[model samples]
Target: MSTPPTSSGPQLRSFASTNRFLTEIASPSSLRPGYVLVGDEIFLYDRCRKAVLSTLVPEDFRDFSLHDLDLSETSIFEALDRAQTPSLMAPFQVLFIRNIKNLYGRGSKKEEFAAIEAYFRSPNPQALILFVADHIRIPTDVRRMDYQDKERFDRIRETLGEWCGTVELARVDENDAVRWIADTAESRSVRFDPDAARELADSLGADMMLISSEFEKLLLYVEGKNRVTLGDVETMVLAAKQRSLYELTDAISAKDRPRALALLHGLLNASDGGEDAAIGHLYMLARTFRQMLIILEKNVRDSRAIWQALWQGFRMPPFAAEDLIRQARRYKSRRELTRALRLVARADLELRSSPVNKVLVLERLVLDLCAEPKSSLYEPSMQFAIEM
Candidate 1:
């Protein structure tokens, strides 16, 4: 997906380019006397706060509580009454509604829903009713009704559509993510080397919120630097716990016994305060390897499909899927991987039960599996290793 054009200044030109409704208001067109901003991005709320101050409304519109209108306690009449209120100063006022989806369902008071629908049918021209329902789908009636049947909803969409223009914000894919990170880092006056951007994208995955926060932190940490290097990213952005586990897995896969042992030791040191936490990390790593084996056995050829299966079944972090997909390519066949997985499973049990040093047990298991002949029996020994 294409990344939206980054605005150089504070003003934005289109809401269609962003999921944020408030950011759209910063566009010159949306600042008109009457406009309705709708959507479920938190940025929209911040926009409303700015708009309220600009309009100079009494009682500090910023203080308006989301809970003020109780769907159960407040009647539709009361809501409509509020929607119908005239602007305090300007020719038009905004009627902001947060969590509009809450107005749905049989549990909602009938009157409140009716009032909301009616206001949509004939929205006051002098009052702009902004609805923010982030992530929730628009109600069926609202979606299906013709303009005449749902005049207010139609009008709101039309107004927003016009102001937002033809641009629609698309989700950033891996390629776009790399570019976005680079651009964002540069815009903040922080150096974002190409390699650092790629590493950041791989680690953060598709979670935009986390990516943004990390970008900011990295920028601040590396302030005054001309370049954000891979080492900088490793130091500041990488999750130490996750990094060590991933490194341990890589070392095992590559048959690097010493490195694998070192990583295991690192994990142990990090978890010094709690032995259970260390065990849990090892369990998670074993579980990840087990899943990799399953995907291989299923002969899932498509990376995306494998990713979906992993996410649906195991709830792994999205970013990890790509790495797993890459790792899956190393196995010559599902059988080989399955055998290796069984070895790891045994290592898992040994760490838990065997009197051997947990780290030593894990290191030995890695070595043995990497040394195993490609033709070894697949299921029983593998299962035995895990069970024992």
Candidate 2:
């Protein structure tokens, strides 16, 4: 539902690509038969999707016209077949193909590549193929993108890029993110203070998804004032600092007791209520550990799989997705994660029991969680234990 950032200002690569896509959407004759949206930066992905959906699929014929095909479940041949076959219910077909990685897995998939090339050679004039290669993460500076992701991206470019328009949906830079906050608020008739934008972007690691979500709340919070300030951001976005909790979980997963404890203390110190917020910290910790449990149980190997494994309400923030997956994999089995969850549950109970020193309760919980469990039994005798 988000619009492309204004082009009057300095354009971030992410927004620039989307703006160009929007431009293409305007001129139907100039539009590519297909486009490879090549990054996991979800905010930009959503923008491109909105553009395509609004321009191509009429609201009345959406059910028949829009196809969300995943390569994980649907084969490339079948998807292409669907594209080739005209829809009787609707005049135009808009197919969104996800899990493009499946085509490049294991074997050479020569048949699949050949099928794609054959289709694109004379693509359906009525059908718009939008392939989502979201498995790759492109930073603001793609030169620094991880080596393996680079390899996959290169392969995608060499293969799909040959026929489809390659759209580089890179991550938004911190400066661009701030500019976006201001411009977005201006479009909404709300004045976003400069300091507020900086603080908001910095605190959330310049994550566009998080930035957009929090920006919505700021708009609602300043409904009548027509202005968003740093104080409003600080008030509305306190719980979102759980990115710090992700850091703590990372340390705990690595069994770095000192770092874990340090992060725990850092979290406590940053809290508005300090000891009184121990329960809140425990709540976030418990939620994160439970999420890790689901990732471990489902064998979520990447950000894309994590989205499928975790539901909307239970999902972690965009910034924490990969970190949580990596942390979840650190455990050899489900028992270790469940044990951590049990520890969190016990700490929650202790916090509720009117303890004299609540910090110590959390500290003890962190220490125990960071230690390697001696029991290999899958089912340990622990109450309030959660399973994915």
Candidate 3:
């Protein structure tokens, strides 16, 4: 995430606002002297770095990948020393530090951090320091300038006062994701109707980098098209696991047992023999169903409310809200929903432990869940028994 270089010059601050980092960095007036970007999203960091450098050195400069830098061998002193170098051609040099979490080690890590603290005491004016601390906590000294807790977003405002500015990088919720898609589509001069963008966002989930790339692809594909439609998104966007899971739900809701079973089998086959990946998919599926069941029990009529509830718990694409509501309507009772979820959980366990035919096992589970009168929920079991 990046903010446009601030006109007031760069402000020393910490970014806590989730995925909107790009929007922040895009601001033409938010760049500062020393920037410590903390997050696990490498793509976000890379994009922010590019954006910032583009503004700082609009013409000529080499792109440096901090990941290539050996943090283990390079001491904090060495890093600062490198940052001290004058720009070969330009007035300023850009230093990109990737995987700042590596700066936190046990033995030598302590020394490195200490050196960093000392270096921060007197930052280089000629060099722009961009520290990418992907998911690692900044030291208290650095954080002291701008701290924000849920109850106190103004903590930074009050504490740092004029000394620094704090930008909170909150996780991109569904609404934000949708808005981002629309904005991105518009900026590319491509038409992204609400439904189409939502579809793409749902398919991409919270992976902004992938979402951005996919949006670009869609923009290119529909170059001359004035506005993108749902059909375009459906044809161009490949569904990620979350969307695929929702597809499975939709198939089950429609009593399309074959389709539901196919979806499950396809997911397993795509697992590449990784038990962890299969388990992770099932875990997400189970959690989604469980939440859907909860929403149904509440008898929530407002689709947006139901979606908001789910988004609070899971990173569902905003476009899937209606589908989830429709699927929720298919479950007449909490008992039936619970039963289906139990079957999913069992299938998850079987996938991990059972020596039996994995494909057959998953197929049976799907069929059972689609059984009518609950046949829609249990038919797979009967089919598996007969086939086996």
Candidate 4:
């Protein structure tokens, strides 16, 4: 699922479930037996995680108090058993249960859910269980949530909602994300220029995590200046990400599979989110392909005409115009670009399915894009062209 690379700006939105969790974490007495963090937004998700850790698990008592369990490896029954049993080493117990989909998988799971109901009814007072359902990606606008995620959310609601508090970690809005950057920068005695913040957010697709990490780098880069400008953002953020991105596109267009994969790994390594940023990478790939499609369709020859051909938000950076135009021209026909987009779309669906080893999924995608199509087939309707 598409998620922000990392969390940004310490402050949460008024409507954020994470904010509510922070408030609730303050009064441990009123805490519920368990909470389900339902979303794949890493920034918001990390905030919730930190709140719980700081409140319940002390650094020294971590070994005794903290438990990171996966239902796939360890059964839910075993997890509840550990929760029910008191820890002599620590005063409180905090369990982070991942791979929660295992519970809702095949079989009626009546025995498992009944055990949950029984445990919650007479839950251990000294323990807290947090179910990380990171598989579901909740969008800023819930109406636009993908069909599969909606179904998963509904199923989880029907089952887990009966006993646990639901904390949705949805994507941050663009305006709010920009505000967060400004607020966070000010906290560190730095002035975040409005244009700079907006450009940074736009360039990275409002990914709070990426925005946050890259802003940190920008802060260090402009240590004495104490002010982040749009120029600094383009130099530090866009040059670092977009430049490498275009290079990756160039390699893919040339069918240089090794170079493309290497560039993909470099992009992933440079990112703080690593494999977690796979969706963001795929989003950019789909976007670049879409741009190439438009350039081809309009027969845009020069970099100057690209401005008129591609719309405002979809336009490539100034430095990448010529490179993008050249890359677009490398494609002999529109079908190739459309085929690339279709591959990206398929990879996107696979990522959303919560596959093991996300990096492998990305690597496979790069390999497919670099591979020549077996048949010179073309869709008359050109359905895949606009599918992205």
Candidate 5:
């Protein structure tokens, strides 16, 4: 006799990518299994949820049928039991259960898991249950972690992987981020320049929630405008915390040592400025130099080729590809980029270990990077006509 099919693992699906399981459920005939959205970013998870809900319930019925359950405080047994009841007022109901710790994870009780597994095997036809995994990633001050903590987190993730169906909402990489910015702007009937979009993405770092928040603000700011520019980004998106760091990078890229040092000092003088600020400055500068180096090393010159290289290599948008190419041309060869990276690395170590002034260490590093081997640091009076 043929062996009975055995369990493999979690049937994980991705929202950004195609999932045959989800495709099969597209028709109204199939049963909708619960979902586990795994991601540190909420924007992707929220987007996945909206799509799922739209497919499950029409917009008109959402107000009456959709309900949210806070499982953190509420007992899992009670929540599951409550979700099992069919809605009298609507034909279908969507029960969104937040904080799924009780259902799965280190602290998840065994009895609850058995009950939940039973529910998954035979769920209510009229109700669609959504168990949102509470693994929202937050900033961790301790960059290095003890092995035990890391193992515990891994265990939690493994436990979450047991769900019948899952949607992993991973963070948007550089290229995807620029694409997202452009797409988001287009959707709102606003014009977003590709270069400007890349600049915005780079400036914002990996915080998609903040990126979306800024996107909304920019959309409203440019309400009647035809296009958003790099200047607009510098004016709005990079105005607050990131202003100094980005300005310093611009100065460094423009080969304006004096301006770059000025911005560095300005940042260091601020109340929040100190070792951290200096380290951040070095890190951003290093990143810029690295991108330029990549462009030069690959011999990628054309905008399309640059975009392809950047997207595949660094996840940068094509629009920003042009700017990087131009900057790369300014440096004669890989040696220049090599020297610059070394300078930053050296500064990082000095600031972390040495008793020297933080500001002085960064200033010296900047000078070394800008100085030509045969000439003094790029002349302060020789200004380039480039806009930051």
Candidate 6:
């Protein structure tokens, strides 16, 4: 996350609005002597970095002209001086300084700051510098920051604002996300249905990096087809979702406590595992319970009939639908589904509010859902809403 640069030049542009980025900062005319690309979103950051690189270094010149420097091991002056030196063989040189925030550490020298400001004021015409700062909060989400954290954030922003053309690659919100998906699919010559686009956004959260990869997979899955329907999305996308999520739900539905616990541990211990994955899992479980509640309300008994009925209403593939129908049969009454939904709701609230281990909270939730159904803890009025 990067704060907007101080008012002076039109060097800073955000990737959140694609049009603004393409029209303003992405243009060759907007290329600056030095750039500060800030954001935690690695994909967008990399994309913006590449865009700048394209303007600086041509593909053939990359071999001889592109310099990747890590500031952690080198001084700021040395890196800038090296970048300022002309390329031996290529027309222009591009220097990418990784983890640039290291240069602004507590023990940083005044000479180093002077060198940086000097380079910015009169940068080398033959070299373009990209200072990559990782893990800075954008717009400085103050609600999550303490006084010291806020101070550090402001200091970094101010320091970079003085030296480099800052561009923030902030997290993509829902509406922009939907448009991004649609536009990306269209660019790939794949027709993405509007409803399916929204569903993809809802299921995948707002991580554009992950969403982009998944969108590619979806297109490949529906090769030769002009239209990507909700059903295609349900089949192809859920297959990916199943790898991360379905096994845990299946274990719970099957009352296989050991397997469920193992899956839960895997989810919590995996590299990308954390509160976000836990929250996604919780919502999936809640959705499953809600589906079962619908089945119970309609009194659909036979697995075949239930699958057929669900096919009309839900966007799951045949195999997943069959599996869900079988799972729905495990519940003997509406109370069981209602109890599960209530448990899921309570878990959702706890996950968001409590500071306890998120994985542990989810583990407890799994235990409750798989355990025997208990009597109503709420009045009949409240039960109806959760259950049905």
Give the distance in Å from residue 203's predicted Cα in candidate 3 to where it truly belongs.
2.5
Q: lDDT of all predictions, in order shown?
A: 0.55, 0.84, 0.59, 0.84, 0.63, 0.66
lDDT of 4 by residue, 237-314 (tens): 855578778999999999999999998988887775778888888888888999999999999999779999998888
Q: Between which residue pairs do clashes occur in model 6? A: 1-136, 1-137, 1-138, 2-138
The predicted structure with the larger TM-score, 1 or 3, is 1
Q: Comparing candidate 3 with candidate 4, which one achieves the higher TM-score?
A: 4
Worst lDDT 10-window in candidate 2: 1-10
What global local distance difference test value does model 4 have?
0.84
On TM-score, the leading prediction is: 2
Task: Predict model 3's lDDT versus the native.
Answer: 0.59
Sort order, lDDT high to low: 2, 4, 6, 5, 3, 1
Each prediction's TM-score against the native? 0.56, 0.65, 0.53, 0.64, 0.55, 0.58
Q: Name the weakest run of 10 consecutive residues (lDDT summed) in model 1.
A: 7-16
lDDT of 3 by residue, 1-388 (tens): 3322221111212222422444545554554555655444444455566666565555544543122344556655677787765555566666765545455434555565556556656656666666554443232233443343322334223322123223333334445556666765666566679987777766865555676677667777887875777766665565654677788888987889889888876565545454346656656667667767867987766655875556465645655667787888888887787777767766765776764666676677778778865455444442222221
Model 5 has an lDDT value of: 0.63
Q: What is the lDDT for 133 in model 2?
A: 90
Expressed as tens digits, the lDDT of each residue in 1-388 for candidate 6 is 2211111123223343333443444555765677676666665765665565555678987899988888888778888888778877998888888877676677856787788888888888777787776656553233654465456567767876676666665665655666667776777677889987876765665566666766777777888877777656655665445544556777888888888889777655542445667877776677677776776677766655766556555545333555666677778887777777778777777777975688778888888777887575333333323532
Clashes of 1: 3
Alpha carbon deviation, residue 146, candidate 4 (Å)? 1.1
> Model 2, which residues run further than 4 Å from truth?
1-10, 239-388
* Pairs of colliding residues, candidate 1: 40-134, 120-152, 346-385
Can you write out model 1's per-residue Cα lDDT over 35-139, one digit (the tens) per residue?
333433333234355544454344445344211344345544665676577646455455544444445434735665555556656666555444443433222
Model 6 scores what on Cα lDDT? 0.66
Which stretches in model 6 have alpha-carbon errors above 4 Å?
1-29, 139-150, 238-388
What is the Cα-based TM-score of model 6? 0.58
Q: Is candidate 5 or candidate 6 better by lDDT?
A: 6
What is candidate 1's local distance difference test score?
0.55
Candidate 2 lDDT tens digits, 84-182: 999999999999999999988899999999999999999998888999999998989878899999999999989999999888889898889988889
